[model samples]
Target: MSQKLTLEQIQNFEGKYPKQLWHLFMVEMWERFCFYGMRGVLAIFMVDQLGLTDANSNLKYGAIQAFVYAFTFVGGIFADKILGFKQSLIFGGLFMIFGNLLIGINPKEFFYIGITLSIIGTGFFKPNISSMVGMLYKDNDARRDAGFSLFYSGINIGALLGGILCVHLGKTYGWSYAFLAAGVVMILGVAMFLKFKNELGPIGDSPLLNIAPKTRKLRELGVLIGSLLCIPFIYMMIQNTDYTDIFMYTIGPLAVVYFIYQLIKIPDSNAKSKFLAAFILIAFSILFFAIFEQAGGSLALFAKGNIHPSVFGISMDPNVVNNGANSLFVIIFAPILGLIWIWLSKKNKEPNTVIKFGLGFLFLAGGYYIFYTMRFFSDAQGLSSLEVFSLAYLVVTISELCLSPIGLSMVTKLSPKHLGGMMMGLWFLASAYGQYIGGKMGASMSVTKENATLIDKMLAYTGGYKELALYSLIAGLILILVSPLIRKLMREVK
Candidate 1:
């Protein structure tokens, strides 16, 4: 039976499929392409070109990612409670576009500005679009999960393409070209979104939509003028640096406090239970992401160090070989995973949200442990070839199936309807924490003659792997242990 579409509902219209959402997805794909693609080569760039040590590079990467998501807490609040979703996304995207463009130019003065704008932009963009997805569907619409699944597919499509293209281009042509390509694609994404504005309708709840445009314009001008006056003092405090931790230190805690206040403000018992679950979800997010995100750092390095290859009996370059695996995995597996969820749901065997999240962490822990154990083989067998690392990535990719796609879904699902973006913002906060911790872990892998030998380094990493396994095991156990309570909290939704 066809479900009745509500009258006030945003009509699917000629562009029934959420044109703004799709455009947003495409733009996000480009943005991620620039972001993660640069990430593919960034550590190497820092170490190889800028002559930074591995530890420094990893630390910088961690701090940057942490601040990027951390800011979303602030951005989401402004977007959800203040500016509403659409404006927040535009503000965020514009920042990201500007940042990517600036970084592509590779100027010292512009580099910081580019990253800063992008970071703040993502803070705004990341949470709001997701909340908009929530807005697209009404309460318990069967299509809600499907909408998120569609969104996840967009993410994978972008990430895979970004990694393959950026890594290959950076290695073969030039980093600048690779960066520029991502920026250009993102710009096109933005243009497409603007072109299709009529199709998007009024999906947003802009704070000032009721206010006159002139008043809003005046308010923005005031902010601009005030900011300009402070620039001289700001520049004195923050000297130009390509990689810095300013945002992590300053914006990070404030974001956390804001989230705390949000949790405290929940007026109803049911919403409070959901908020409680969201807090636990944050823990699981950290565990899942810290382990899964090794692709760009530890796993990336492992592939470089080991992994044997001769694709189709042709000697493929290692850089291409390394970059290509993730893209291939995402392309192949994402659709399959989506289908699996639908099938599971039809069979009435779909795992509850917490269980799914628990399994996600366990899967990542298992993948990393497999790779870490593979180290034993690499040393025993004399630096195992590309195939070894390839298998490892395959495992990580499967683990990603368990974690990455479902996180935001669970965020939207478990959160109260009114607080969609805030919950999504908190979701990224978990990722920000994971990014920070992952970077710290990666940085600790930096080897020195004084600290340990190659064997010692392997042993150290093994210890880290063991710790991750324990963390995941413990987190999974907690989820299962608390399953009854969380299920009760979920009430009739379960």
Candidate 2:
């Protein structure tokens, strides 16, 4: 608006956030509580409620998540290109509210709807909110990373709590109650957002809306209403989970092609540099996610079936016991991780995005290797649950620290305006693919203990985990070695 506003002015806004950023942070925290809580229990619910085999249910959970991440980009694009970020976020949040409500009503009937709502909803809200936070600062705003870290921490608080909430609700009350709880939390998140619209204070508004005349605004609203009406048909195409691959292939390519077209169209001065660097990073990020995501799906079951929970005095259910290490790790480490970056920043040692990612996968490698190293124990235990509960999750969190938070921030930091949302979609596609692989891998490991020797079945499961971990380890090493070149390609950070 006024010379694009200096970075200093923006930082000042973060400081002066008309109504303490706490409101925004807490709302997101609780919503995450709902979402992650639902996730914590989703696979279990499918197995326990829907009567799907444990392997089958976990695959379904993973597949749905992959698709949801993929759509985050779509949400980003529609907001950036058409609806603007705030509107898109609002739309997505509302959609999520409805989706959760429907899930509560009858998840079996509206399973896809609930899941699709989350995908589309996250697409809109996730990227833009971060972008909006970014806009509150000027270029190279020193506090920017800290702000994100704080916001990122809010998300995990929910996730940590979710381990307890969804598990308890789903186990004791019913799966429907769990979904209903998730729905109410979502609605509260939306309400908190609407209440604080003024605090965002025009940051997330459609730029087009700002420029257009009153008549034009009304016309745009009319068009939006028409589009909203068309959602049912869109739902039809998205309904069949069986066509998941077709959706992944089709939507991903379309988003990419559209991004290429945008790269060709925009006059962002640094467009070529931005496109190349972002594209490479996006490509690699997918690989990072593909394997790292085994934590929740295949790995979850592994923890449930293989790991023993009762160690000292306290006896706990495997479901809760399984997710325990992750909850603890995230709670303890997230702040420390943020502080490390800050410490690094002061010394100019803060790694660039590419290297951060490479490190993320390296962490992935390290984490899975922990699993491999513990293979001896698992082998000895003959698939005892203890090995998985204590060892597997501990390893996964380190990897998650590497990939997850950084993944969110990178999308906001690197992606160009026109294709930011689409690139996010591509980023998610990587996760989707990883999840699909995780499922396929998990499904393959179902060699019946009845059919094979106990040693043989144990070998089958451990073998796959070790192989995947080793593969990720090598990939991480390669990324670290080449990080300098990748960093150079980012072309002297914005």
Candidate 3:
């Protein structure tokens, strides 16, 4: 019998990444395929199949996405305290599989129920995987960022395939096939994890190993049962956006209070300062996501009604472009960006994480400005150029590369090991707020007139984009101005 690899042994491996990283990468890739596929179809499915207005669909989409992210915070706490990352991930994956299967069976009747399960599943599956990745590297490893960048690519690759396939299947074949495909991929992800999880050794083992085995089992069972019990309540909240509003308002403040309590409990002042810095970054990310997340809501509608069906004179589905183009761009560019970061670091010229985040907002502003300019390029019937739309996604991908993966790496660097899952949850909880705000913004831009033309929609959506651009620019400037203070708080992390 072979001895399992210890955490130190895994962390000290003499290379850019551990072999186990690839296994986790593959698992995450398949899970993302399931996730992004469903995300691509949600708003369009509501509008076309469920007979929702654009405004209502956008609001519902926001509510759904918000729930998905908010639950990650809850999932993280549970994983940290009760199930450990491995069991939580497996439990989450199983629920996700079941959720998609249910939707596949009857999308209209069981939509909310399936979605509720998926939201809970994603909350559990998402944060733990990222935290596990963080455990693969030593605290000060120079390659941690690069490893995360590679992991980030796996997510985009899944998104790219899922985005293209799900929308194409849902549109051409049937919604069942599209959703079933998501379930199938999720199963593959879980299977892959089961096959290779031993490579993680003790990293994700239960924290309660010292306790009585029966007691531990009972606790874990309690969490699983508790999660299932919440499904009905979640279904109710999701079906009503007013309920979503109440839940979001209440949950966010409570999470903040919990975070502050945890912060106060940490014994080291330096660690506390880093936690504060992480919190600030997480807060700013809410604004970034609120603007960036327009891709799923208003942008989906814009693609459906107001965009040309050709890019560079080749015919294609505009919704497919809207859904998958950013992921494709990220796939192509993430490695190159990783190399650029390494090169800059070698020369002592790389910007700190705070500066990178601020630069992301600047790029985001530029992308939205391009989206705004699409109004000028519209033809008589209000259809705009797909080439220009692709250009905006290219810019937005750069912004995402700057912030999203780096932010993941940053949270791991800032947090104490025991709190890793909770902090990661907090990071995603910020995204939940962003999704909530984004839905409202998309709703605001939805043309409400009964006989509204494509031209009216183009005008309304583009005008909203212009406002978003101005707000993004102001945010970027503010972040840059405050970078020094944030950098001081970060101390030695960078």
Candidate 4:
């Protein structure tokens, strides 16, 4: 393995960021393309092609998203202790490709199989890559935040393409075509990572501890076999919303217990404080994501059924506008925000992580409030102007800018170096929890094609949005009020 790049070597190199960062950025971009592309149409596909009700489709979508993220915790264990990050990521990407292929071939017959593979694959892929990015920099590097922001922009670049192209193909031709496109992009991503493996060098190499080769190989095999064994369990969860609910309930409390256990094991008060701060931040983040994630389920449905298709005579697909516009805004804003943070840091005026999170909640409230305004202006047909609705997405993108990228960086900084992979997975697990809650929220606002009049659907959805707006605003204020205490817990973490 190439010698690990030192801070000196990294500094001496004349680049703004490592070449390896760009390589990983491209790989993650394509991975997001595959994931988001399929996501853009998944709920609609279930309702339209698989002939499920809106409620069933939303629940299933939530289950799929939940499991995909939940499995990342398992993947983190394998990466940290068994397979190593590189192997886990490659295997994850391959599984994702095959999953999409299976769905493209015949989603009606192979939907469960496809979803199961994608979930396992994402488990292996997602956390490891982000972990690897964290590995690229030293613990206290000021450039770390900016690097993550650039990396986040890459994710959205793929998301922009996926949302636009996948929705267009699915709406214009067929859902199968969209799945096929996702698979194709996933294959490209896998190939790119494999070809450029050397660029990543020893960043994600096996741990230094000596274990017998035979034992290591056996553990690797066990990870693979164990993942396959969980497929049936995942399949059941997808079919039965109750199981998904039960899993969410079990996992959230269990994660808290596990974190507390880790805290007790740590002897250093300073280190312990960082973990406490991280735990607090993680908890607050769940509220933001739970509300924000309605974008893929409830918000998408509202866009499809309630928003006018044309704005000023230009026709657009609702899925494309709803999903793609968020990414487009992120692409436009991420760098600018990154620079703002850097400027603030120079002035020693940067907001603490907790305050950033508070801002996230505030912006989330703003986004939902914008959507809530549709209750006033929507027509008897329940159609609102696309311009007004699209503005909501733009607002939410600002919230994401505050929360998502910073959350990734915080996981790296606050967690023990040895537990970095698992902590990253925990970050995603929080997202899994949010997704399940979001699913429930979306399901509560369901508007089935058969039963609901336009006005009825509008009232149900808009009422939900209004409630969410009020709740998020209150949550933001609470976070801001308590942030000074959380800042003390963070100690020198900033």
Candidate 2 collision pairs: 7-138, 72-123, 73-425, 290-434, 306-384, 306-385, 307-385, 307-386, 308-385, 308-386
For candidate 3, the per-residue lDDT at 21 reads: 85
Local distance difference test scores for all models: 0.65, 0.66, 0.93, 0.85
TM-score, prediction 1: 0.86
Model 2 per-residue lDDT tens digits across residues 274-312: 566777777776666667666566666665566555655
Pairs that collide in candidate 4 are: none
Ranking by TM-score: 3, 4, 2, 1
For model 4, residues 1-494, the per-residue Cα lDDT tens digits are: 66655545643335447677889989999999998888878888887888887788788888888888888987887788877789999989988999999999987898889989999999999999999888778788777777788899978899889988988888899878898999999999999998887766566776633788888778778888998898898888888889888888887788788778878999999999998888888877777778998877888888888888987689877778887888899889998898888889989999878888889889999999999888777888888888888888888889998989999999899988777888888889888888888888899888656767878888889899989989899988999999889889888888
Alpha-carbon TM-score of each model against the true structure? 0.86, 0.87, 0.99, 0.96
Task: Encode model 3's per-residue lDDT on 1-494: one tens digit a residue.
Answer: 46888998888887667888889989999999999999999999999999999999999999999999999999999989988999999999999999999999999988888999999999999999999999998888878888888889877889999999999999999999999999999999999999888889998888898999999999999998899899888899889999999999999999999999999999999999999999999999999999999988999999999999999879999999999999999888888888788888889888889999999999999999999999999999999999999999999889999999999999999999999999999999999999999999999999998999999999999999999999989999999999999999998988
Model 3 alpha-carbon miss at residue 354, Å:
0.3
Residues 1-494 of candidate 1: C-alpha lDDT, one tens digit per residue: 33434424553334224544576677667666766776677666666666666667667666667767776776776666556776666666776777677777873346545656667767877787777666665555544555566666676577677777887776687667777777777677567656654444566656667789888767655533543453343333223223235544655567567667877888888877777776676767776776666556655554554544454467765555556576578668766676777777778887777777667666666766766675665554235445555676776677666666666666776787667777788788878777877877877765645644445555555566667767777777787788787777775453
Q: Can you rank all candidates by lDDT, best first?
A: 3, 4, 2, 1
CA shift of 64, model 4, Å: 1.2
Residue 61, model 1, lDDT = 64
* Total clashes for model 2: 10
Indicate the residue-level lDDT of 268 in model 1. Answer: 84
What is the clash count for each candidate, in the order shown? 5, 10, 0, 0
Better of 2 and 3 by lDDT: 3
Clashes of 1: 5
